[model samples]
Target: KKDIEYLSLKNLTVELSNLVFLLEQQKLKGLILDYVDLKDNGDYSMEYNMRLNLEYIHFANVEMNFFRWRDFFKFADFGKIILEFDRLLLQENVLSYIGLLNSYKNVLYLEIKFCNLYILRDFHKILNKFKYLQTLKLNRYNDDRNSSLYMFEAIKNMNYLENLTINLPYRGVYNNSDYFFGMQNFKVLCLTGTNLTQEIPNIKIWGNYTLLRTYIINKAIIKVYDLIEILKIESLTKLSFLDCDIEPCFNYISVELSGIKIKSLDFTATNLDVLKNFDIFKEFARLETLHLSNCNLKSGWLTQTNQSCNLSLKILHYAANCFDRNDLNRMNNLEVLEELNLRDCKFYSCGFFELGNDCKFLGSLKYLDLLHVEINIEDLIFLKSFKNLKNLNLTLSDADFFTAKNLLFYLPINALSLKECNKKSIFENSYSRYLYEENINLNLNSLSSKSFILIRI
Candidate 1:
């Protein structure tokens, strides 16, 4: 079933004439209906050969009516509509789904979760009738006290929105961003405000969007000169300071994070734990993929490397911090670090990751996640000389079932993990004597002796 093109009908009571006989026998192109309780005035306008080759339609907690969803979107002949109208119950079926989206004028990606478009009375002129709406998400988790505050000014005629998400809490969004000025093709924006402030500073009136690129800070708490003036927008690359909150002065925004040209930086549970001078990762000369989960750096973050280190880092996640050994040698000078997650850190032993040698420090490490690190057994014995090591995770306290049975014999590990070990029959009798040693054909204890296996040859 993974040859999926997309078909979902959740919480079903499916019946609109067998749901238009399963969208004309599934000649589908993405259709999702959650909490479906179909049958409201069940009228399929003579199925039109079960009209539907839909180009994406997601309706959550659905309710059918507006001419039974305009006869299943006029039996969608597969073109127009990237609609994701979610979890609704708003009556007059959202003004008959905005008069069935004015006959689907090529609807381009519109998301309205937890719906209540202020009862659609010219709701932003009915979302500018999708004049090629690039992508727009609104009212997600719309704090319903019987939903009301809505004031969004119809995004001043979409004018080709590249991507805009407006989470309407206590709602008051009114965009005209100078009608998407300089037509820079806005890249991505998530505007959040309940009672506003922490500084949106009206996103500097969005004029010189200058090709804005990814800025999600949903659930506002923004500031620090309105997020360093929206990361100095010179075609910003990516900044997801998710679930918001910023004002933790990293050297007072280190001279506005030095001429920003952000290249993927997500900091969940933000504030960067009182940021101890990562000198703002030497001002992003193209920082590549850094998702800092649970930031807990006590001064000495990313420990060293400056003189504009041009860090094109390849994925590093310091999950559940307390990561020791100068935080894994401040990622051994990030030499193109290819994926690493020091899970549940703060190693007390196992030679503070001198791991008995061979990890010339993240030498282009091919994914390593040390879940719950309290290492031993010689830090999984020389960490099998990491160089492009495929995937590895350790748990059952990093060895001692006969030193994890020579851990797949001097590790030629394509992917290996030893989960939940507290001598559970010594890892199920050493994974049944390492799968009866079929001449030790290195299937490395075949994954699950209770989870953590990441098969990646």
Candidate 2:
């Protein structure tokens, strides 16, 4: 073994062959032949010797290009094995690999991502064989052309598995039926790119599984009511919905979630009217953080007649909405409001004026985003009233009156975005002047030329 280690052969095949021969010859204690592409050159004797030295081996990214099935079976009897067959055409070899893995009852962690295991018929049998398996991450690249139905059922039978992350293409038919059945020991369930529709599945069985802590349903069309109902289960504390369509009102929330006690909520790119009813907020008073990005509020007529009743709201985000000045003033009752995001809201002139005064009442506000809002010199002065303001964003150049220089002198912010501002020289001059006078350095980082400047204070 020492002779082979110090040999330093140039050809990888020769080097690996020599190492394998030496390992078997001396009966080595440990071996690591990772990423050494071994070809089947019609010589099965060398492969047999390599497998014989598999008492203690950790193979990683090992290309099994035309390797014998018998050789792999012998290699699978190791104390610990790490197999990586990335881009290997496992059409006829999957059954043999599964059979090999099933023999090893002591496998701890198995991660297979982007492999060509098209037909997973014996997947359940394979999963059942691993009695001591702790973690399993199976991510397959499937599309509309190849829709697999029994994949979920194969995964659901793994009773002893603790953590599971399944990333497959959208299969609405299969997801609606038999996806959430059996084996309820998952602490974290992450379903990515699954075509889950708006209709709620019969997940009454999940309520019995108290171990589930994190549930992430991304790129689906799940309704808000269904989500709230799912959260009604006491164990869930973290929930995230990405690119999902949610109703604007809580009228559809038939089930109550007030007692669920969720800590974190992410409703990114979902509808804003989901909070229209306010019953869910009034129920779940223990909410610490809430995200509502790309949530449109065109229908949320913020007249004195229609005010929001969600008093417990702390972090309010209205990214990519069409809220005016009145909308800002109406949310003054949110006394504990910590962060306010108005990114891409296309704010009019009056919107800035309203924010300057009305926002002062929010004593707990730390982050404020007015990105892409139309603001002038007066608006910058109005922003000074926010004593608790930690961050602020503004337009680089005021088309109406103010320049970057005038805006810089008004407030001492931490980060600034001056991208696409016609007066780049003005910003540099103002920042240099501020540094000379107050001994404080200031720089402007532009988000867009006409859009806004983000300043971290």
Candidate 3:
């Protein structure tokens, strides 16, 4: 089967000419048809050396009449198409059946969820026929405010539109921060709104947006003077404040809005407990990724100020925040952190060698999630002092089975998930006699030796 290249077909009743002859005899390049029931076997002839290089096609809750697969997307030859569609039953009127996706006009990447573009008419003439669209996600676009500024003025002249996701938050849809001042050749602009707290239209028209890098603002309200003109745009470098609510007006400003070349700053579930002393991360000194997941952070919510004491943070998520030890020693100034998630946290009364002795970025961590942490085995033997821990998730941990076989016999872990662990002590028999010793190699789910240790239960 040429090692099947991604094909997910949920539910049944296929026959779209036997699902395009099973994606051309299993040469599939990704195809997920959930809740399928396609059936349109009239065999709309196309056999002259028939070719169909599909690059990804997802059709959720799919039934049929997707324009009767428009003659199998007009004699298939799709390449970079990443077309997704949820709640599919398009029958019609979705912008007059969105020109039946112009019969696959290269659709670079397009996601349309829960379809219902409210009162959106002439949606940019059906998105300018996806002129090789470069990523576009639209979900529940409850159009209003001039049909959402004519759908952001027809996707700002598309020109290979570089990522534009509009998930209409709260859905009252009145957005208008000048409907994204002409997108300036957007390089990722996610806007979900409620009020997006208008007003911004100055700051030299957002420094002409200079090919805006990445700017997301979901569940909006933002108004610290429109987040200082969106930190003066200056070619933004990734800035998200999902589930937002800023508005403190930077405490009646008095200077201090430093340089800011934003190097990723997603305040997920953003509330920041009311801008705890604000210090907008001392105005981003090229901050290296900081997501503050589910922010309900305690213990001085980071404020050792000396301008955030030289943060060289290289990824720190802080999932479901519930810290302690002075909030893990104030994230020991993100000592060159190299990825740390802390998923669904709850370590309040300190554990895991007190978070490996008060988080000094857990000794240059190399990816660690700790999903649903309620850890055990002496707090999973303090993750052997994270000597550059190479990927460890522990999905739903409680480590047993001899503490996950003593953490794969002393961690040098190169991927360990343990998803809902203890599946019959993970095939015990003394763990298949330590995987038949020798050079090691046990399957069912990873456990090769001399390195690659992905033991995901």
Candidate 4:
């Protein structure tokens, strides 16, 4: 009880006053009550008039059928409030819920998920009532009526909102770009499954959002031209396109521009073939982090033409591709690369084990992920060239005890992962299990003499 700083109560029945008393006695910092039935016991309500100050309060999967919502807020003053209900039955009107939230003077962050907010008409207008909210995340289940259309119009005048996320799958939030005509600057804007293919009459209006830092689009339909225009925002740094269909607007012609200051660009699971006309590095000259995972890039994709360009990329994720040694060797311009992820890349019989000899990026790489890429004991010797490599992931590489021992003794990595698959062929063998345990013991003993290393099997 003395050591406990946070308490979690799930799928239980407890009086709100007793819960508060328990937290007060222990001086707990946070509380997570999931699927709990909270009751208002008037017996101790008057005795515990003192409000309990908490760092965070999370209520998830709780059915509000029998719980008194108004009574729950009076006992605690929370810094961050997260109310997630799978199915919420509001006994009172939605305004009462908003009033209860507005009464809380110290809530800085709030997240409400799957609360059927779309059922309430004009629900977005009441959002500005939470004047102290700095970060707000509202996720609604998709409805056929398109109720979320007026969602952005409601938060346009929110003066204190810096971070906002509106995730409503298959919902068109706005019809035109004029929805953000006079909006204040945001630090982060994350929208999933929203339509952003509207035409902008004037590009200068979007430049007003200079304070925007990170923009993330997941499974959204956005045009390539609109994306390029949005990248022109002055302070925007990180941009992610996850499972998004970015249609080419420039008639299959490569578009080039300068002065875009974005640092991180993620195109994970995106259809890169749409933008095959443009050279990504040449287009985003200041890009520091690039993720091109699962883009179906094969051999000869990074050819001599790529060698002529010098890249400023620090991290490169080339997972789930078909790049061989020749393709990797062409990336010699990645001298400043700090992290390289070649996970699930089919380097079979491609002499990738000797990649350290030709790849100039190995010296500067701090983290290397080779998960699911087969490596034998003979090729393991080449990994010694990674002098600055700190974290190495060799999960599912099927290394034996001797190979594992050699890695633990030779590599200067802080974390070495050698995760094995759960197949009966590997796990059922007693000899393999013996070797695995022996390898753990050897690695553990080496940690004492050498620098600290986290070995995970």
Q: What TM-score fits each model?
A: 0.34, 0.60, 0.35, 0.75
Q: Can you write out model 4's per-residue Cα lDDT over 1-457, one digit (the tens) per residue?
A: 5878889998898876677678778887888988887666555434444467678878786533222454456566777877675554541242355555544457778777766534445455555555567888876534433445455555665667788886633323343435554455578887765344422223345666878899887776667777667766768889888877777675653455567778888888877665556665555667678788987776656552333224677888889988766675666557788988888888744755656576777678898887667766655677887788887766433345444664545654334434442333333433234333344322434433212223434
Stretches of candidate 2 exceeding 4 Å from the true structure: 1-140, 143-149, 167-182, 194-203, 223-225, 247-257, 272-279, 299-315, 325-327, 330-339, 352-366, 382-393, 398-457
Residue range 1-457, candidate 1, lDDT tens digits: 3356778878878667777677667566787777677774444456574566678777666766566666566556444343445434543465455655563467777776544433444454556555567887765443432222222334545677688776533323223323333456778877665543434444464447777888777556665655556666777888887555565654444444566767688876576544443345666667778777776554346553342433576787867766456655555666666887877666532244463243344456787777556656656665666756666665544345455665545544443445554334444555535523433223435544554443333
| Candidate 2 C-alpha error for residue 342, in Å | 2.1
RMSD of 3: 15.6
lDDT, candidates in the order shown:
0.58, 0.56, 0.63, 0.63
Candidate 3 per-residue lDDT over residues 35-104, each given as its tens digit: 7887765544544323577777776656666455554455565544433444323523333555655534
The residue pairs that clash in candidate 4, if any, are: none
Best by TM-score: 4
- Per-residue lDDT tens digits for candidate 2, residues 1-457, read 3543222222255344655666667665455654555555566666656565344444445545445545655564554433445554543263456565445565666655545444355455665655565667656544242233445554555556777666543347445665454456777766666454533343455665578877776666655655666777688877777776664443544654446656667777765465555445445555556676675656233332212334455676667767665666666556667787777776543555666554535467677776566666676767777668776655544344335465556554544544445445555445446423444333335333443333343
- Residue 136, candidate 3: C-alpha displacement in angstroms: 8.9
Q: Which stretches of candidate 1 lie over 4 Å from their true place?
A: 1-9, 14-37, 40-67, 71-129, 132-182, 185-257, 261-281, 285-289, 292-340, 343-369, 372-374, 377-394, 398-457
- Greater TM-score among 1 and 2 belongs to 2
Error of 2 at 121 (Å): 7.8
Clashes of 3: 0
Task: State the displacement of the C-alpha of residue 225, model 4, in Å, after optimal TM-score superposition.
Answer: 1.4
Model 3 vs. true fold: TM: 0.35
